[model samples]
Target: MRLTPFRAFDWNLRSCGLHGHVTYRPDEEPLAERLHTSTPVGEAWRCLRCGTFALGAPAAAGPADEAPLVLRGRALRDAVILRLLAAERGIRGLLLLLLAYGIYRFDGSRQALRKTLDDYLPLLKPAAMKAGVDLEHAGPVRLIEHALTLKHSTLLLVSAGVLAYGILQLTEAVGLWLMKRWGEYVAVVGTSIFVPLEVYELVEGFTWLKVGALVVNLAAVVYLVWSKRLFGIRGGHAAFEAERHAESLLAVEHAAALA
Candidate 1:
């Protein structure tokens, strides 16, 4: 038989033990070959190249590798569904921001807003006092309300922006969870766009908790985009194609076996 490099085959040696050595030779050649094959106690084969019996007996026949049947079915379907869910979440986040903006525009009372300056006023008081706002006459609540109302439009815009960002984050998270390679790319690009802004915010204000939150978000974005291999657009497509081919091969094999 013609010897091919890197070719794998199953050889059956009747008398060889698990660690027996066997010789392989061209059907028409005078050269003797030795190789080792491994096998369980009763079924062993030897490699013709080496006299060592470490090589195990080869099976009569088998496929090179078994495709993961379950992953192709339930796992892949689940990934698709998750991708849809992620997209929906992003849309929802966008709607929330829009609703916040609507509330800012329609509701004159600052307290009426769902997420308002009133909520963040407590956190800002210490800063305002440090910035030389008189606490005696200007109570924290009053001061914050006045500032918020003064910049009502700006605050609304900021809220809308944050909502939009949240939506984007949701999209990326969902995409990653679902294994859509494009989701990963989009997530990385989108999140990276915000990194500088987040850094600026942290530097300007220097709130411990907010800074921590920014750092965590940044780290997550980097991990998903780089190390996870989800953002490799070409690689992802290739993986999908390979999965499809494996599925097709499995189907064909099953059909043949049934036939």
Candidate 2:
């Protein structure tokens, strides 16, 4: 009777021991020594050093208490999507804010420019009145002049902030779109840091729009940190280890079968 090449060869099992080599069947002598031998077949083929599978596909060996390995993949994908959406939202918000500022600063049409000045005049009045500015002559032209005189430093500071924020948001959007882990972290940390400040603004102003913005931002923070799974202190490391372990197991099994 003719035997298959694998059966006639007494294929050496690839060693998963700390020292990388192959172990032949003859080497499986003393029980203690056999335990270290890499020739075990079927479900029992495990690395002596890591207790990982030495043949076939690696068995799922994640923490017993944790969810199945399949779930981790879904969770990671969901987290990544949520992070990307959050980044997009931030970029949109920044763009809108910049657009509003641009309309106020450089709208060329006279009527539109005047309307922009008029809309903000009410907010400026209280400050101007406190400084004893006469409003009778405060038309668009004089009003703009007075605004520049009273709030030049404030406008400069706010403009600088908007520019910086726009750049940061754009960067964050690009990072998240690329599905980078660091981008996930940055989105969670940066957005969460602003929650308290937004809350403070809501408390001070108590406007419906302000309240809504605060609520939306807070919800975004919660989703990214908890549901996305990227913000977990150990999730990234655990996922990386699982990938490496799977690869190593596959390599060993392939080598053993070839041998």
lDDT of 2 at 181: 63
- lDDT, candidate 1, at 117: 48
All candidates: TM-score:
0.41, 0.44
Compared to the true structure, candidate 1 yields what TM-score?
Answer: 0.41
RMSD over all Cα atoms, model 2 = 16.1
Candidate 2 lDDT over 83-184, as tens digits, reads 557566566757857765763474334456557667877777788889898554655568565554445456656666767666666666766776566766
Every candidate's lDDT: 0.52, 0.53
Q: What residue pairs are clashing in model 2? A: none
How far is 171's C-alpha from truth in model 2 (Å)? Answer: 1.9
